[model samples]
Target: MAAQAKRIIEDAVVRKDAKVGDKLLDKAFALAFKGLVYAQIWEDPVVDMEGLEIGPDTRLMCIASGSCNALSYLTAGPAQVTAVDLNRAHVALGQLKITAIRHLPNYERFHRFFAHADHKENAQVYRTMIAPHLDAESRKYWEKRDIRGRRRISYFTRGLYRKGLLGNFIGLAHLFAKLYKIDLSKVLEAETLEEQREVFERELAPVFDKKFVRWLTSQPASLFGLGIPPAQFEHLAGDERMAEVLRRRLEKLACDFEIKDNYFAWQAFARGYDRSESAPLPPYLQRANWETMRERVDRIDVVNANMVHWIGDQAEASLDRFVLLDAQDWMNNAQLDDLWGRITRASRPGARVLFRTAAEPSLLPGCLDDAILSKWRYLEEQSADLTRRDRSSIYGGVHLYELA
Candidate 1:
């Protein structure tokens, strides 16, 4: 089974006859993604849910990253949500979260486990409550020890938010911020948007101008922690300095929304959610939605497979909504067609597909088959509006496409 999973990824590396540089870069990205990557998702679920407009009859399909967004989607009362990922660690995390939601005693306890994310009791909760409910695969994955000889689950008790690839990347950024005498956590304390922008311009924005920061951002490897493949890096860095792009995105994160309620900003800057106001919590972790989420948690089915491969296996027109979170940025033209082909086959009438890109324009025009592309109406205006409102502010564009 593991061999098959590995091959599934191996098979995804198209351009087999490409130049040495491309091949080497592809190999590096595949290796980086093969292991545990995102401990927490980077996308903005508020923007995603708004764009999706999920309802009781919505059958959503998505790439499950850290399981945060999938759980968030449940609040909209979707009839079903199928989350597929190439990473087994990601699938395990999704499954563990679902299990925790179903079995945890209350919303506070749930928050303590994920939001607080470093309580020793979290490991205890896992042993007594969460572990039993996890499948054999997830159980084994969490039980596995790290290089420090601690169980991977111990992250819950030891700052879970600071452990994964993305987490460590943010940690590195914080270290750089400290070097420049800028405290990132200050953004979290700002009471309003103007204050947030003032703090960012005063403290955070200057850090990007440092030579060390600029040099680091210029390297493709520096962004691997953000789960950005080298191919995507090319798009983000095109005709502009990578540091400049990063600074603009950071400005958006720090200034575009009120820091008190934008949990994405809080997480990026402070490494955790706003503990004082439960309203800032992810939808699944919020008090009011916990019971409903708990009831609806069973609707999600986690799968360890490539998106196209998995979607191809489902019945024709089985899915109603597709959340392809920036995965298309990594694909070549042929691969995009393959993915969209399966999507067309698997999508029901009126299905809406939402995806983000590392670059501004949608990836479909020159890549996807025109006939297949014709089946969907690109929601260009709505996507642009949502892209500006995305509090996460890490992506270049957010796109929505509805089946025509």
Candidate 2:
């Protein structure tokens, strides 16, 4: 499974016939991506749910990054969510979350195991309660030792959010801030948007302009932690310096929303969800929605496969919604055509497709074949609205398309 997963990721990321330098970077990205990457997906599920307009009858298909969106979508009562991913660790993580939800005794335990994610008792809880019910593959994945020689399950006891590639990337960012005597967490102390903006402008924004920070951001490999491949890095930077682009995104994350209501901010600044009782959380982790997620968790089918290939196998007009995340930024024109061709075939009438991009404009305008692209209409105004509302703030665009 591990070998096959690596191959699948390479197929999606590594472009053959590219220049030598680009090919090397792509290969390095594919290799780094083979292990655990996103312990929690970066996309905002609220914006996704709004864009997709999920319903009770909705049959959704999505890239199951960390499976957070898949589980969160259950709150809308989708009939089925087929989540496909090329990473086996993500597949295992998805399966584990579903199994843990079903097997864990109550909401508090479930919250601690996932939300708190640093309780020493979590490993014991998994062993005594959740492990027996988890599938063999997921169980083995948790039991296996990581490169650090510690069992993978020990992450929950230490800090699950601080373990994956993104986790380490954020850790590095914090370390750089520390080197400059800046506290990234200071943004979290602001109680109002005004104060948030003040703190960001005064503290975090200047770090991006530093000589060392600008040089670091200029390297394509520097953002591997955020899961941005070399190709996507080009799109993300566009005409600006990479540091400037990053500064803009970070500014939005810090100032666009209130800290009290944006869990994404907490994750970015504090490296975990807020611990306060009234803290905002992903829909799946919210106590009020816990029962809904637990009841509909079975509706999610996590598969270790490429999404386009899996959609190609589904019956025509069978799927009601699709969530592509920012994956299209990683694809070439031909790959995008293939994916949209299958998506067009599989989409039901009025079916919605939601995806994010590294740039402000939609990638489909000239890249996707007209035959497939014309079958759907882009919701320009609605897309703009959701893009602004996206608390994650990592993406440049959050686009929506509906079958027309």
State, as a TM-score between 0 and 1, how close model 2 is to the true structure.
0.99
Highest TM-score model number: 2
lDDT of 1 by residue, 74-191 (tens): 9898999999998888998999898898898888888889889889888789999889888999999899987689889998899988888888888988887777788777888788
The reply for model 2, stretches above 4 Å from the true place, is: none
Top candidate, metric lDDT:
2
Write down the RMSD of candidate 2 (Cα, Å).
0.8
lDDT of each: 0.86, 0.93
Cα error of candidate 1 at position 65, Å:
0.6
Tell me the TM-score of each prediction against the true structure: 0.96, 0.99
Query: Model 1, stretches more than 4 Å misplaced?
Result: 1-3, 13-17
Give the lDDT of residue 152 in candidate 1.
91
In candidate 1, how many Å is residue 254 off? 0.4
